[model samples]
Target: MDPVGYSHDEKGVSKEPQHVISEGDHGADTELRRLLSTRHLTMIALGSSIGMGLWLGSGESLSSGGPAGIFIGYVLAGSMIWSVSHSIGEMAVMYPLPSAFVQWTGKFVDPSAAFALGWAYWFSYCITIANELQGIVTVLSFWTDKVPVAAWITIFLVVIVLINVCAVSVFGEVEVIASSIKFGWIFVVIISMIVISAGGAPNHEAVGFRYWNSSPFTHGFKGFLNVLPTCIFAMSGSENSGLVAAETANPRKSVPRAIGSIWLRLSLFYLLGSLMVTINVSPYNPDIFGGSGTNASPFVIAYREAGLQPLAHIMNAVIFISVLSTGSISGYGGSRTTMGLAHLGMAPRQFARADKTGRPWLGLLVTLVLGGGLAYLNVNNSASNVFTWFSNLTSLFTLFGWGMICFSHIRMRYTWKLQGRDVAELPWKSWTYPYAAWWGLIWCMVLMVVEFYLAVWPLGKPSSAKTFFANYVSVIAILVLYFGARLYYRGPWWVDASTIDLDAHRRFYADKDPEAKKTGFKAKTSKTLGFIFN
Candidate 1:
């Protein structure tokens, strides 16, 4: 009997047993279903990422980095994300598990690292849920100070929880609708900025490159570096697509397509959006630092300055929707990640339980409790203070998660070669390869350190001890979790390269007809649209 291969049973058993992790092995009775399509996966990434970070946080980045600095910061951050996404995409297509990186780290790196990364990643997403909930109230306050912040937070908390408890298909449908609105809103804003820059608005001021020339780099290089954290937060959700790979149908096809489209999305939505904001709004606007509300949004400021009060109000409404969409996505991701930890035996078995609808109800309940409680902080703390604390905390954990992904991928590649596996057999392969993985790992670590420094010693002035602690607390927490898990597990510092199992749990399906071809304009047009959109 082979230890790693299937063998016949004694009682005249026939056919090979599936070479994948079974629910019983993990002490669970059910598993998540593959119901998400390509469109759902794509929109999950877009909807999760294009939230308060861009709609609200960009103003802070622009104020610090200036127009050119902000643009450059996003480009640099986008490149780093590209590297991270490609690395994870390769492994995800092969494994296709929820919170796949956690399992990948356990297999290819070290079990301790996996435990730490899983919990840290879960914490990041949980905080993100809270942060987006806070964003709801902040954005709504633009229209009315009538409602208390706590009331709005409670309202959104219930809404997000309800969305997560439903079937994943329902969640996907909501995301598709919300993401479409977000995309359309961005398109309108970008076009409006172009028109305003061309002196088409009532202002009739040709603002072409005017802000850039006046203040290309605010506060100098330090300022440029300052905005990187904000940009990272904005780009954090790029990995949500890969996280959903396990639940996505045809992951081999859909996952890669979704990951590949990230570069385009970042360019079109983030870089272009930043460019438009820089052209239409000045960094010196008092509202640029409007302290955690819709008015702080550069888009809103630009529209109002152009005397388009109605348009500004509409943009505010769109932002509120975006925040809600992102909050819901965060809850979904966080719940799944918690379940993945349980699947790996790092958490209680109940956490791994799924309802008939394939919803991780226990995980969802836990995430809701934590996130909702955190959202209440917004009621007492200043919005800006709450936002900064949550943003900084999430950014640290996110960077750490990216580092683990890159490191795990590098180890996986080495083991793949050791096992004599053909590269061509991989469902997806990262084009940048060894270089990209190394680049991503190094940069993510560097940014993590820089963020810690910035937290302690902010650019302009000395931060209070409480503020500094809030900013750097994530770093300490992760370190403690890693070492604590190591002590308990007592696993090897690193897994042996030759012992890595690349074939376990790989989804096997019948081969498709490679020679089949499509013809006609409708087919060709459909293919073209899929290429562009996916």
Candidate 2:
């Protein structure tokens, strides 16, 4: 299929074609509808990243790493995420393919790398769906245990599945709304924490740096190292914008703008939230480590500490919605990755079929059904433990997925230079040639090492075989996939730069597409938040 075609309206604004998917169209190359605008791209990217990772996982980080440890760990993770975004953002602008990085690695690096990373990334998000479903059950338990865990899982699973099966426009709108709510709630949490920190709450007790002074590092360096995996998990979904590049109407503008704003979200939402949580609540609070849901969230705990129980209830509700939103994103990412695998001939072709609305119905069904089935694992075992295990395993996949992304960027850049391509001719370029990508790649490697050490010698318990495999299983799976693909394809370990087809699937924004010239309320709103959405 050709790239999504656009036509200009009477007002000179770009409009998407209303072409419905043909019933006979079952090819892997069917083009997705370019209904997602710049605003949709920005909002969905933010929405996807600000889920259970920040709301619930931060509590685990606080318990293990103390206030200072979580803050510093997020800072480090934020930096690495910045690099990954730029690295992929630059490439997405050039290729603008569905599941951009998976295709990029195969095109610029090696087909085997793409096969391995594609499946690994798909599994990570698939497990994320299960994890978030479990998270929903845990958050609901904060209110009452009257509803059975399976009941809540079924309800939300159906809701998320509905969202995924609809048109990309509907998916984009739902994400935009969810992201707007999350964005507003984050500010409320931050402002309330500031007030509570300054002795402005009902108790009139100032929690000014008390936790930091008392226990900055709960277990010292080992504890700080322990927080890295949690940080990795929390920062995992920032790449969703790049994944939907094909569906985005103006990737040349929207992809970079969407990724360019990650730093702002990281600083304002993640880093600031981490700092506030550290100040407002003591890391020693038993609740910090008790639950795997909102009850343990630093934001909720902060409000509870400030004697604002009602707001804590509201926070829990918001986080519950946030988890569901994350589940929606997980389905979106996982299905697209499945479609990408099929397109690359790495998976069965039937999975690539899209429905009338350009929804990858077969892939979406597989992702949600399997993911929802996995959610049942919590019914018998401890929900919290299952959540933790799933999170740790996914984090390991995130490490490899992100590392390969940056590595692909490095290879792409070297190939571009070797081909004597003019940097100015490219639509977008990474912030720093090679350096940022290198930093991101090295950070992922270091975190994997940290994960390995923790897997062998956990913070307190005796190293067990279960713990080791739990952490390293994703790494082992990726290696197996890589080698399996290698044996089947028999391609070079690293793709030759000279032989790379840089022009294959590369999108050039010239006179044909007028999407960048769009004007409307959404574009104006984007301009108002220009610092981020520009």
- Give the per-residue lDDT digits (tens) of candidate 2, residues 1-534: 111243455855333344322112222135566778888988877778787788888888888899999999999999998899998889887777677788788777777888899999988988999999988987887778999889999999999999988888899889888898988888898888899999999989997999899999999999999888888888888888888777876677688778867877998889998898899877767775344444467788888878999999999889988899999999999988887777677778776777767788878888899899999998997765786788889899898888988998988888989999988877887767688899999989988988899999988778999889976788889999999888887835776787665775566565433444658987667556763553
- Output the TM-score of candidate 2: 0.91
- Per-residue alpha-carbon lDDT of candidate 1 for residues 271-368, written as tens digits (9 for 90 to 100): 99999999988887777644333445888889888878899899999998898998888888788888878766788878887876678888888888
Show where candidate 1 strays beyond 4 Å: 1-18, 21-30, 289-295, 463-465, 513-526, 529-534
Poorest 10 consecutive residues by lDDT, candidate 2:
19-28
Best by TM-score: 1
Give Cα distance to truth, residue 275, candidate 2, Å: 0.9
Number of the top-ranking candidate, with lDDT as the measure: 2
lDDT of 2 at 230: 80
Cα lDDT of candidate 1 equals 0.80
Model 2 lDDT at residue 345: 72
Q: CA shift at 145, candidate 1, in angstroms?
A: 0.8
